[model samples]
Target chain A: MEVRDLNFTYPDGTLALEDVSMDVHAGEIVAIIGPNGAGKTTLLLHLNGTLRGNGVVKICGRRVEEYDVKELVKKVGLVFQDPDDQLFMPTLYDDIAFGPINLGLDEQEVRRRVEEVLSEFRLFEYRDKCPHHLSYGERKKAALAAVLAMKPEILALDEPTANLDPKSVRELITAIKKINEEGVTVIISTHNLEILPQIADRIYLMNKTVLAEGESDKILADVSLLERAGLL
Target chain B: MHQEIDKYAHNSPLCNLDPRMKVISLMTLIFSVVLLPRLELVSFALLFSIALLFVSRLPLRFALHFLKWPFMFITFFLLIMPFSIEGTPVFSVGNVIATYEGLKYGVLIALRASSAVILALIMIATTKFGTLLKALEKLKVPNALIQILMFSYRYSFTFAQEFDRMRLAARARGFNPKTSMRTLRVLGSMAGMLFVKSYERAERVFWAMRARGYDGSVRMLSELKAGRRDWAFACFIIAFAALLHLVGG
Candidate 1:
């Protein structure tokens, strides 16, 4: 995945992104770390054509706008921070099957995918329950499972660790690593620095633009850079 | 929190019955009750509704609690009927005549309304809301209407929780509500904030849906299959409704 000279301004005249450029190779876990209002969410929204900015976003060597919207979502699955927003279907089972059903898959295929994700996430017991009934940690996993059921090549998550307990955070990191091992490129934007070194293969520290990009160890060692980005 | 009726519905022995059959049978029963010409026949319908409540295994106390609102609403109209209608006077209070014909008319309306409401409640109390909506969808209800009902039912709980949180926040800040201009102002502001928050949430939800390949329409796995028992139960209920109509006629 590649983004070049991306610039985005909200309708209220706030510049959310400024000439941002980045790249992510296949089978790598990339993390975008920054302070609040750093346009981390806006950038992730552009990955799946949810928002059209002023620059090019390429997935698998094709321009974002070049592929149809339906086809684009299958290639890059974007999970919102709030599971409530993403899991709007009446039940968790329906929510997980939503994307595949929209992809025009047959009923049997959709059911298979939903069952696969439910067992993988250990959410089979709550399949018929409403999303609101699940705990925060379960909701988070269910949201990710909902997106993963589509089998996207690139999974983009916004604030995956926000509002989670320590155990849930660790479990989410492990899940991300497991997904990466299975060959799904993962990109997450978060301000949580504790899990950065553990899950991130590379880190991009940014506040509206690419401040710095390097291996996780190099970025973690740069105190002055972290201070300037407000991580301190 | 789950609604009281929803709890019973999920646990009801009748829950496993196909929702389409349940809806069709109960709806037919409601129509028969409403169409009954004699107040005595309406009594039979009311008895039948009580029988349904028993079969649903819903406790009498819960049913009475659920009936309170509709009964209160219907009472307002029933009170005015005896005073407004022209008939033979049965009694008088402060020159206001209460007539036997008006009393009979009021009783008929009350019985009919109660019977219909009870039957409808039985239908709702035996099926999950989502399954009920799906049954409606399969019964030729428009997809757009079904979608609207589905989302409204699903998000009502979310919004209710949001409102509860705001209320708690107000209480934590030492805010006390009473009937006054100040209280009204605070309430108005809270309502305005809720509207703004809901608007923002709606936009985010739309984006989320689009991200998951949502086109204009929604599709779900239809796991409803009517078996022989469902058909038999539906036939029995419909036949019973016809018998009531015939006996009344």
Candidate 2:
């Protein structure tokens, strides 16, 4: 996945992402970090064509604008920040089954995918439970399961560790690592530098623009760099 | 407590009865009561007895309060008697005359409506609102309406919470809703903004739905099926209603 010279602004004329550029190779966990309003989420949305930025954003060498949303959503699964915004079905099973069914997969295939993710996330017990009733951590896992059930090539998450407890964060990191091992390129946006120490192999410093990108140990070690980006 | 008015709030023998059975039986009884053309003491007594027997063990005080509301409704409905179809006069007072047949007609209609109200209240008191919706869904009611009802039930609380938050925010800023027109306008705008925000939220919800794999149809985790008890209860209620309908009609 790659983005070059991408720019975007809100209708009220606030520049969100300015000339942001980055790349995610075949299989690696990339963490995009900055202070609030850093446009990390905007950049992630651009990868899936949810928010179309000005310049080129490519997934597997195919430009984002070239592929339709329905097609793109399958290839580049983007998980939003809010679980409430993601899980809408009455039950866990239905929520997980939605993507495969929409893609016109047969009923048997859809159920298989849902069953697979349920076991993977250890959400098998929550198959019948409403998403709203689940704990925040569980809901996040369920959201991730919904994305994983789609079997996307590239997985992008906004604030993957934002509201999670330590245990849930650990569980999520483990789940993402497994997905990464499956040859899926994973991108996560977060502000917590502590959790990223182990999980995030690559770091992208986004400060209303693509500030810097390199090894996690090198980029996150620079207190001056983080401070300059209002993350201190 | 008024909580007794909600029947499905606890576990009991009556709580386990099929909703369809309760609905059908109550509807039949109510129809039978309505069929009475005059204030027949026997039929009135029978209706009252059935209503009492149905509600007796659950909670009597709550039932009495529940019964009071229907009396007012009966009286209001009776007011239309004079304007309805003219009938044999029972008495005369200057220009106003009381007709026996009209009074009878009014009494019968009032009886039916009150019976319906009582039965419905008892059913509501006994059944949880969520289960009641599920029961309706099982009855092959339109899926669209059932979905709407379910969504509304879930989100109405959210809307209330949002309204409360907006109210508190307004209050913190020293804005009073009742003191002046400007504040009233602000309140109105707040409501408008809430609707807009909820609509926007609905769009976000759609995106969420898309993320999760929501196709056109909304699916439930469990399919509500009538068990043996449901079947037996349904058969008994149907037989009873049939007998009443035939015997009363």
lDDT of 1 at A137: 89
DockQ of each: 0.78, 0.32
Candidate 2 chain B worst ten-residue window by lDDT: B1-10
State the displacement of the C-alpha of residue A84, model 1, in Å, after optimal TM-score superposition: 1.0
Model 2 ranges off by over 4 Å: A65-69, A105-112, B1-147, B160-196, B219-229, B239-244
- Any residue pairs clashing in model 2, and if so which? A98-B213, A99-B213, B6-B125, B7-B125, B7-B126, B8-B126, B8-B127
lDDT of 1 by residue, B1-249 (tens): 546456677777788899999999989988988888898889988998888889889878888888999999779768867877889998887999888888888888888899889988888877877778779978988888888987787778788888889989998999899999998999899989888888999899899989999898877777899999899989998998899889987
* Residue B203 in model 1: lDDT: 93
| Candidate 1 TM-score for chain A | 0.98
Model 2: per-residue lDDT, tens digit, A108-145? 78888999999988999988676656888898899899
User: Clashes per prediction?
Assistant: 0, 7
Candidate 1, residues A1-232: lDDT per residue as tens digits? 9999999999999999999999999999999999999999999999998888999999999999999998899999998899988888778998899899999999999999999999998999999887878998899999999999999999999999999999989889889999999999999999988888899999999999999999989998999999998877
Query: How well does candidate 2 score on lDDT at residue A15?
Result: 96
TM-score for predicted model 2 compared with the true structure: 0.72
With candidate 1 superimposed using the best TM-score fit, by how many Å does residue A171's alpha carbon deviate from the native? 1.3
